[model samples]
Target chain A: MDISFTSLLWGFLLIIIPTYFLHHYRTGLVKDTLIAALRMTAQLFLIGFYLKYMFDLNLWWLNVLWVIIMAGVASQTIIKRTNLSLRQMFVPITIALICSVAIIDIYFMGLIVRQDNLFETRYFIPISGMILGNMLSANVIAMNTYYGVLRRERTNYLFRLANGASAHEARSPFMRDALIKSFNPTIASMAVMGLIALPGTMTGQILGGSDPDVAIKYQIMLMISIFASSLISVLLTLALTHHKIFNKYEMPI
Target chain B: MIQFNNTYFIYDEKPLISGFSVNIARGEKVVIYGPSGSGKSTLVHAILGFVQAEQGEIIVNNLPISPDSINEIRQLTSWLPQDISLPYNSVRDMILAPFEFKANHSRKPSDQEILAEFDKLKLEHNLLEKGITEISGGQKQRILLLTTVLLRKPILLLDEPTSALDAQSVDLVINYLKSLTDTTIIAISHDEKFINAFDRKLLIGQF
Candidate 1:
């Protein structure tokens, strides 16, 4: 079912419409768009070859290592996107991502999928990647909102602390704001999922020859896992980094 | 209950308060008055460990203001900062927030007690139900003042507390604060009425 090179080239031709609009509107996005498309194609092809080889080999340790690598990359991306200090944030975020992804992957592959080998390459790698990728966006939004509010409303925090609030109590309001902001979009998307949009994971499975019924069930479980992993990772990252980011006096560093 | 011994504070690489020395006794109401950027606010904040003294030490309730004793010091004091921006929908929520803290759990004021303070501060009973955004600047200031008073802390640090209040409201606050016989009050204010009402006055940045 793979498309031939000629057909793929035809698919690349579809980018011309967007390029024409960019040029006509003087949006200055033509070069950026073309470069991004080229970069995406190159990266996907490289991963495609790597995954093909990995799936054929199907070694447990290799699969675990790959998932760890994905989590590391996702953590680094979250730190960079949030514009937080890498030295302070990288380890905590990486640890949080790895731990949360491992929990969800185990629950999905062991209990639900019931694979003879829990670390089966096909189930382990893709499922972990999906969870990590979804979590990256949520962590970025949550961290940004949390730190932004704390920084902007510093006086409010100090007011609470001076009025006899513990450090945890003072930070509760900011944490509430972050959680609400990060989860609202996901909640809305989940509510209108089937009616408004066919999710990317479900569509990919259906196209890959999975039965529609099976694909739908997988998609449902995936949505739940994404939400769970995101919540756990966001909380973990905040907890792990809290001491580092605050002074002994409970003021933000 | 508060001592500053030759304390120095630096902000932005410049000495803001240099070699300052003061010993405030318990139950004394002291007023600090000076021009803007004179470090008057910073001096009060030093006691809370919000701004550290660059060269000297501050002691509150006989405890040195350090990381180890900061929580203990804060638990004994209530600070109403110059810039008050609370994250609460209604005035009552803001007033009640501090009581929810574990440190202040035992000091939760009764509704009657809160209403009495509200009346003393000239705030109407219905003001508590209004959203914070719906209240005026003066009302917001009084409401914040009421919260600090309700904590019943032994030390009160007020920074320009009456800046937004009218003359009548200012007198109400001054009289209420003056009546606290066992509380040590350290305030920064430019209001002549507020300055005159204090038991003693210290002009900062003069030396």
Candidate 2:
């Protein structure tokens, strides 16, 4: 809300790319700088448009539907990033996101704050969008680690498979890696909260005239939701990706 | 027992080994000797299901193997790969890797068994505490051998298990491998000394 639409849009377009290469981070510097600026603008503009219309309508079914769509798109990105098969990824990941997101949302809306309408536009839309965004990021990290570790330790995984380990056993190392990688940032962020940095959500709350204590409470709830969502999503992705990547014989290359 | 029927392997659509057919019965210690680029490593890798073959059938223990069944075949076979990269946890973890699988999970050998194998390779008891990154190439090869042996697979596929060893180390490895002849040992190497008293030789040519 604090970020104006024109500033956000034009500012991104006006992004100046550094032409000369720096010492260490010079790999694709100009292209990356330009592309990143463009991508950020386009992505944020698209989200802004979508959010405007979505909030205007404010229907519960539409909100729920959007969340599902966001989840699907996020899953697709995850699949593409990891180069994993998509045959059976839909069910496990969707189920994980729904369960984890709903748990925290229900507690925040129903029990703690007890908002007037459980499906109100003001509360449901922003929180849900935030949850979806967090979920997407967490899953990317998780799925990335899972796929990377599996590839790097291919021999070890094959060795496990040969030793009569099931598909789960073969993928245990990757699963552990995925879960750890996915959850690490959130854990670190929480650990350093209010000391090293103030999170965006809490800052936004303070700017909106909310008390610091209230903002802190909201931030706490969000951390829990992000953590929970990340954990469940990572676990689900790891388990399902194992099945999708491996054949009936547990071969992963 | 293993059978390679007209196996043809290609990488980037370029044939490495073509029309290569061979067979090995149980407890037969056969050596595959070839020039550097003759696809000897490729053939060994193919049998392990690591390298995909363009055309041909490979049957191990009477089961036809595709790229997928590499895991199944690997369970029943021990491997000392030509590239001896043991980049995992500690040296102990590297050595005990075979026992961590379902096929050999129940057979996590006692300390005495591990110590015996280590002693046989003239390794020290303290080597178990060291990390894989800290081990020498020869030591890593010995760990790989012990790890592969712990699998107790019927077929043992070795790729230059002694190519880098000193004469004494080579002698030790060869004798230990010789004693484990209950396995169908098909070793790929160009070392004339190792193959001097070998049971049989399959000389490979440029593909």
Q: Pick the candidate with the highest TM-score.
A: 1
The candidates' DockQ values read 0.85, 0.27
Clashing residue pair totals per candidate (backbone < 3 A): 0, 5
CA lDDT of A148 in candidate 1?
92
The CAPRI-style docking tier of model 2 reads acceptable
Tell me how much of the true interface, by contacts, candidate 1 captures. 0.91
Give the worst 10-residue stretch by lDDT in candidate 1 chain B. Answer: B198-207
The best candidate by lDDT is 1
Cα lDDT tens digits for candidate 2, B140-169: 887787777877778888888887788888
The DockQ assigned to candidate 2 is 0.27
Q: Relative to the true interface, what fraction of contacts does candidate 2 keep?
A: 0.28
**Against the true structure, candidate 2 has what lDDT?**
0.75
Determine which window of 10 residues in candidate 2 chain B has minimal summed lDDT.
B78-87
